[model samples]
Target: MNPVATWRRLLAELLGTALLVTAVVGSGIMAATLSPDDVGLQLLQNSIATAFALGALILTFGPVSGAHFNPVVSAADWFLGRRTGTGLSLRDLAGYTVAQTIGAIAGSVLANLMFDLAAVDISAKTRTGTHLWLGEVVATTGLLLLIFALARSGRAAVAPAAVGAYIGAAYWFTSSTSFANPAVSIGRAFTDTFAGISPGSLPGFIAAQLIGLALGVGLLLALYPDVAAAAEKVVIPAERAARRQRAASRR
Candidate 1:
């Protein structure tokens, strides 16, 4: 891809991630405000809003940067595609991760400002414990498995809905409420709202997510030895935009 194309991809990752975090944090705040006494109702509202917004974001940005929005997803793409040379290069991976992280932080700050809260209100909700860590592991593992499995099956078209659905379900099933993305985990630390995760709990949650990434790779390899062929198209057809750019340039 040309330099311009590369920059476009990075920009898509940044904006897509920013919007995703905005939906997460903003919806959480809205839910809390609407259902102050009913925590369960708040969670339901948050999850539903997040799921719908996530699916829409993926559809919007998938063709550009694969809609990764998460460092773990980008890392997994690199790891799985390294041998076959079909996925993101090391440089691209680094760029995507950085963009996603910055976007996450920016989104959180924006959400806080929207709610009339301090821009850097650090989370006080302490989420720790081995059980919670286990939940993170499971949530991350399941997320990767779902994404890669869809790729391997040549079903990337459904990934937007599938991923959104999985995350929405994970929120209810997992003890940690499925903060499966490292970038998201870090972003939520900036808010004291219902979706926030305390900074102190970040290390353990991130570690578990990394571990889950490894286990997910192992499982994918075992289940589909030829999965490398689809590694570049994890959440969607990442090359579609590039192909369009190349074609337009030729004309």
Candidate 2:
């Protein structure tokens, strides 16, 4: 990719991720503040906000950077593209991941600042145990499956709504409330709030998410082998435009 294009994509990833984390952390704080006595209401409020914000963010940034906003999704795209040479290059993958992580952290800090709290604080909420890990696995597996399956089925256009809806539902259903994204998980660790997770518990959550990612890839391979072409359309708008141009030239 050209330097300008690469920079644009990176900026998209960073800004998208930062906004996403801000939604997650900020909504959690707002919900907790407003619904101090009702845990269920707090969760409901937070989940709704996150779902809406995610969908909007995806719609805004999907055309520019694919709107991954998650490390696992980016890695999945890289892995799927490796064979067909239609996805992100190794260098691009690295850039996306780094940008996402930084964005996530910045988002956490921004949310804290918005609430007049410290910019960075270690979370005290300790989310652990086998059941939680299992929850993480299920949440992440479903997330990956939904993403890749949509890509394979030529329904990438609906990703904004579909992904946001799935995540919103997962929040209520999953025991861990679906911290499926490693980058998001790390960001949440920086806040000591209703949605925060303790730093010590980060490893287990990330490991489970990785396992889920693997399972998602395995299932996609087993069921949608022919849809590898669709996988190429997961994101990366520049490539999509290039492909369209090539087709236009042929016509």
Candidate 3:
């Protein structure tokens, strides 16, 4: 319940997400442009690049933040008893989401500037396609499962590396090559560039991911009976700031 611990976790997640989004979107774009001959192979290469970047980030910040740069992972961790215990309040959610959004936008912006990427409209996501939807399902489920297993055995120390490897493997198995983070998925929608999913198809793809995440949680519950002890409640943005103000006032 320490304030310092909360702050450190917040900062760590922000840093990790910033690095993650940049590596994911940036490398993805580069691969697509550099190897337009084979879209599938380019995407696979990009996935490997993302994995390595993520692995490095985790090793750097995992101890400080548990390196849960994704909301899903953080929420899952809280559900499974891995939260830092200052309490995963709405304040945490607000802080985390704000940072994540900024990081995603900035990452996309940087990628655009660096690679001459086109500005894709928000509504363009509709073309994500059925294959992408299937990919999201498989990728997200695999990601969550990897996180759950690594975290459960106190092997969380190596979570970043383990997570990166899962992603690399998932890329080969899934057709869409995995857009696991919702924020990143939405951000990628803005670029009509090589990595953008069709805005119209975003909903279906996201839905599949949500279902996959649910299934993953169910599997973990059965496999690791103690996982629920880590569940963290989703904090509504507006409510969290007020709660923090009140807590500070009390102090």
Candidate 4:
């Protein structure tokens, strides 16, 4: 594996999370500040925009970094035996979590600055509850199903589109605006601005998403038992072929 590339991938995650959070919170604030009349419409447009950007980013950088924009996705991939380098180091998880959270908070702050809304809490406008919980299940399940289809078909090439479309559609169809990510959920909680989950809403929302992720992985695996075979081999071996050859000659 390219060690340099690995670091680059991690940095990409950092940058990607920043960009995602910025766009998401920015759109929400714009809706509140500008199109308050049709907040729903604005949110829909925002969701589409975010989904497209995320999809394109994943397509562009997936080969280099696996395009794991969400911590949950990274964790899921590791759980399913995709990312195998020491398998989720505590230090890296902490670093990634901090990066995602910071990026999220910075985005909200920037949105606040741009909207000039007198430090209003952004979470007030968010949707959550048992309804939101069910939405999480629906949205995340759709994501996992789409991903499972792509992987099992040996269509890793189409993963980014599959994932993006799933999220985009889930946003509307599920009645919850489809977060489907734990890091993003926590980040959004810091604000009471547009698209911010009410501070009171964050914990249950996070729990729902985590549960959805677990169930999604489980369901996808159950449905596609052979999905792992289609996965690209990135395993590191103990011996180099040249070393094996020299040993055979010595023997």
Candidate 5:
């Protein structure tokens, strides 16, 4: 791949992630402030904002960088493509992860600044225990399953809406409110707000998410054995359509 293309992809990942975290943290802050007396209302408002923001962001960036604002998604793509050498390169994986992590943190800081808070503050919310871990596992597993299955079924075009809808629903169903993405989890830890998770709880959440990633991969392989076809479907629908048109014109 061209170095220029690689850099452009990395920048897209970074900006997408930053905007995503900003939506999460900023909305959480607003929700908490506006509905200080009603926790349920606060959660509802935050979840709705997050869902809409995520769908918009993915639609905006998927063509450029797969819109994998989550590290687990990126890692899964790399692993599934390893044998065929058609997915992200190891260098791309590393760069994406680093860019996402940095973007997440920066997003938290930006949200805080926008709300007239400190740039960075440790969260006090402690989310732990077996049930929460189980929630994390279920959330992350379901997320990966949804993404890969869509790719395998050649429905990547619907990913933005499907993913966002799933996440919004998971927020109500999952005990942990679906902190399924490791990068987002880390970013939330920087805010001492309604959406923030304590730094001490970060390791456990990440571990559960990783376990979920493994399970999701196993399910993907078992259900979609044609890895090559699945990989090809990862491209956005517009690009795929254009390529088909070009091929037909050539013939």
Candidate 6:
């Protein structure tokens, strides 16, 4: 395979995140429409669709950018690999973050337009309370742990299925329905559908996710003492890096 370029990596992150958000918001709207009277059924439908879409997206984009659709994930990669220079550089992390956020917003607008709703309807679904915040922390922590653990264990090949499975399960287990991703949360705020979060709730949820990042770092240190060595392969191996190694070996 050809080495992936920086622009290709950024584009992968942008497109992957956009599609992920579209799946989330779109499925929620479809679920609500299909099962108007049954909230439980709607949630199930939404979760299933999101899970499948996420796994497919990761598989499609993993080699290009390591499939980091979440800002915290990219941050974690940079932090862990700073000493070793194995994971993303600071510049790459910044680019990925910007692309993911912009893609997420665009995704929300697209979802809304598809459903015949206002293109930029701000969500009014205020999700508050300490419980919800705590849920976000738990969800984020678990997600980080899973990703890092898989990388460290050399099981990154299964990340698509594993990550998708975890998020799907977290939806039912976490009170906040596993809005562990800040970009996703921000994108969701642009829609007033079942997956939407009020703009007012962004602060608390984002803070909780940050806290989760801290805790995840601590836990990863204990669980995978040398996780930094595997940081470059977190979600998947970057195609450019992998190609460079092959070229050096052949030389």
Summarize candidate 1's per-residue lDDT along 1-251 as a digit string, tens digits: 22337888889989998889999999999999999999999999999999999999999988877888988888888888898787788999999999999999988999999999999999999999999999999999999999988876656778899999999999899999998999999989999999999999999999999999999889988998887866766633545634544685799
Q: What is the C-alpha lDDT of each candidate?
A: 0.88, 0.87, 0.66, 0.65, 0.86, 0.89
Give candidates' CA RMSD values in order: 4.0, 2.5, 7.9, 6.5, 2.4, 2.9
lDDT of 1 at 52: 93
Query: Candidate 6: where is the Cα deviation over 4 Å?
Result: 1-3, 235-251
Best by lDDT: 6
Please report how far candidate 5 places residue 9 from its true position, in Å: 0.6
What's model 1's lDDT at 203? 99
- 97, model 1: CA deviation in Å? 0.7
Worst 10 residues of 2 by lDDT: 236-245
By lDDT rank, best first, the candidates go: 6, 1, 2, 5, 3, 4
- What TM-scores do the predictions have? 0.93, 0.93, 0.78, 0.78, 0.93, 0.93
Prediction 1 global C-alpha lDDT: 0.88
- Model 2, range 37-125, lDDT digits (tens) per residue? 99999999999999999999998888788888998988888887778877778898899999999999999999999999999988999
Model 4, position 141: C-alpha lDDT score: 65
Q: Candidate 3, residue 172: CA error in Å?
A: 1.6
lDDT: worst 10-residue window of model 3: 232-241
| Candidate 3 residue runs with Cα over 4 Å from true position | 1-8, 82-87, 118-126, 229-251
Q: Which ten residues in a row have the lowest lDDT in candidate 6?
A: 235-244
Candidate 2 off by > 4 Å: 1-4, 238-251
